[model samples]
Target: MGLLNRYAETLSELGSFVLPAPLKDMRVGLFNTTLANELALPEHLLQPQTMLDWLHSPVTPLTQQAFAQKYGGHQFGQWNPELGDGRGLLLAEVIDSNAQPHDLHLKGAGPTPYSRHADGRAVLRSTLREYIGAEALHYLGIPSSRSLCLFTSEDTVYRERPETGAMMIRTAPSHIRFGHFEYYFYASQKDKLQRLLDFTIEHHFAECKAATNPYAALLGAVVTRTARLVALWQTHGFVHGVMNTDNMSIHGITFDYGPFAFLDNYEPGAVFNHSDHQGRYAFNQQPGIALWNLNALAHAFSGHCSVDEIKAALSTFEPTFISQYQHLMLSRMGIETNEKEQSLAVMQSWLQILETNNLDYTYCFRQLALADINKAQCPFHDIFVSQENRFKQVTLVDQEKTDAWWESYRKLRLAREEETELLSLNPAVIPRTHLLQQAIELAEKGDFSLSESLLEATSTPYDARWDTHPFSKPPSSSTHTSLSCSS
Candidate 1:
């Protein structure tokens, strides 16, 4: 409950107070009833007129004076001090039934002092993309911000072209980022920077306060959570197209979804954000980039932590990430072994098979689990042999080589009981880019059937029923896989 309210007045210099701009013909396009119930939101607030009125003018204790946060970021490895909540506002903080506090953020609310020269509005397409992406990652057992509701308007917004303006209510443990501390630190406002750090620790990372050096403990906690988070992303083949420091959540959840995608084929070098021409945020580069961002954050904590302690905290990233990633990868393969070197070899060889054969990453893993449980229905070759025609650019995997790898894999495979664990670890569905575009196109035409259906599929990704659904397959032909950050 102390999110922004506890410091908005004291930290007025950190942000600006701005009410949401009224949108014409606002309609609730999608809502997360499950989340609403969990938050115990009153039924009246769920109504369109009442909610819209509250967004523009707050009267209930549920909300406070809305304000946009001020922060700066290192974008594409270059420090940019002008970035912040350009079109979003921290409307309020709500404590759910479980007493866990969550920030209620409204994206596309309106323009603010940080909007620069652009209109502070989000298109329906991008709004839905963020909405679907957050939920998809959350349901995949990954840490992520969750969507509360989406409201579309008749007001037109222009990006690459004209589109309907929309707003999404996003919920997260906290909206604080590494950039928040960076902004004050670089501005030479050490007092404000310390205040921000203490506030963040008090509300979010309270467990660190009991340590002899709370600041160093906070850094270590962030590093550990971030390592595990990015490791999960790699095991699931997720590509976070933009890894700017401003987009890095202090809570270590996948935050600021923009130009993000799941790997259709296991291409380690894949880049999904069109603006990333240099492939700085490529799929394979996420772990390195994460460490880089942590190093940038370490600069902000210099006043509170000694260089050696900060380095000690940062040094945990690599081993933590490797341990988490190795465990997840081996679990997906149903390989139960104490030999780390042998398991790493098995994992690398399996990845080579997928890359060499151009197999669908999701399908290959799901099929592997199925073959172990039901070999008659899901043969092992369904991934290697049957998918050869789909990929013409590369030759099929060498049969002799695959046979050798298969023999090595068989020796490490777990017992039959591990099949269920494998199936749960490997999802049968992800929010594929092609399918997301289709949902966006249809939603633009006021047909939300596809979007609704896609949300359901993503929210229950472990269900095998989706394997045969049209949404499960990758794009038949390469459509526009990259995206602009306009939204």
Candidate 2:
């Protein structure tokens, strides 16, 4: 018997229900089951014995014993009191080998009391994006939800169009959101709010339980983690695209990979989601937006902590984010530096050059990792569209400014001891917006080979040999901005 089955024997068996043939093709595996086996989860969970015998043999209705959670959020900065897990169901929780608890959620299983007049089915395209995106982030060393299984059914789901339906089994340290606290606090449910706070502390922030002001400690931890997470995202050129209050995770993991993109060109104002009219969640604005969301979360804890304490905690975000981002950027640049100002100046200069020249962000940094200062020729300059103009501008700048910086950078690189090591920190390939669009387009036509290959290449993004793949390049002008959120 599987570990899950053995574990399940201890808890009251929740009745099981057939996923319905409509959702079969996309079936993946349970998160804990996959990690427990130390084996890659099968693309689909179709084993009869595992489903029938191990997963509670008989078909049963989903238990409705737990009350659905209610949460309010400032959607695009306007308060909306009616928001919850409208289409999501929390199946159960399981303890992992580390003894940490994880929530197992079945997204698109069915509608709950919170379902607001919409079917709960997820489309295959979105399911695939979430599955691969989450897995990529996890492997990249970013804290994120893990994708256990993806189940596709024959059932058709209607959004803007009729699409094949699917469901995803996602595992997270906690599903509790910033908005969850907002719900109780805004409704003036002090008793319930305190109950939720107590539960959160005991479950997710046990270290803070002994603190005189546990809420303050909790807020500080969240702020610190969130700052680090945003730094990771920025360093990798990832744009979350939609950073609403509800989408922010209390545990600081990156969740909800909706309309996201990796930057091709380093544009500070880059916008990935077509639905975002005001550019509220642009690439450069993410750090500020994260702070805003954290403030919202801090507001929820206002009953237990003073305004000054919360502000102090929130203030840690900028410094923490900058420190983490600088460390990551130095590693990417192959610079070993304890000097913050000098290293930050080099990083900023490179970003400024890339932004000025409209150079591909990933390629520019990857090339700079191999720049040769002695030759009086910077191969890194070749990535720019008009190298002559850029080089001329570089020459006109104070030579001392450039020379001193490069000399310091060279010494820093020598200290690091390996050029390849630094290059490895910056990936040669990313899931570029154009390529993702192509994969989505092909998948919609029932062809998945391109998508599969792209997934394979992105999983091992640092591999230089894979650069020969045509999809690795920025898209032509015709298809660059044509992508839609629906895909």
Clash number for each model? 0, 17
For residues 212-259, write the lDDT of model 1, one tens digit per residue: 999999999999999999999999999989999999998999999999
Q: Which ten residues in a row have the lowest lDDT in candidate 2?
A: 1-10
Global CA lDDT of candidate 2, please?
0.67
Alpha-carbon runs more than 4 Å astray in model 1? 1-4, 7-10, 58-64, 373-378, 414-420, 478-480
Q: Candidate 1 — what's its lDDT?
A: 0.84
Residue 108, model 2: lDDT of 69
Reference-based lDDT, residue 178, model 2: 85
The window of 10 residues in a row where model 1 has the poorest summed lDDT is: 373-382
TM-score against truth, every candidate: 0.95, 0.83
lDDT of 2 by residue, 1-487 (tens): 1112211222222112223222444433222354434332232333422432222322422222222345667777777777876656555565665667776566666555455676656777777777777766776677888776655556678877887776666778777788878878988878777877777888789999888899899999999999999999999888888888888888999986778777776788888787888988889999999999988888888889998998889999999998898888777887646666776777787787666655567766766754674454344434453432533444333344445556666665665545546556767667676676566676655666766676667667777775566755554431225234542
Best by TM-score: 1
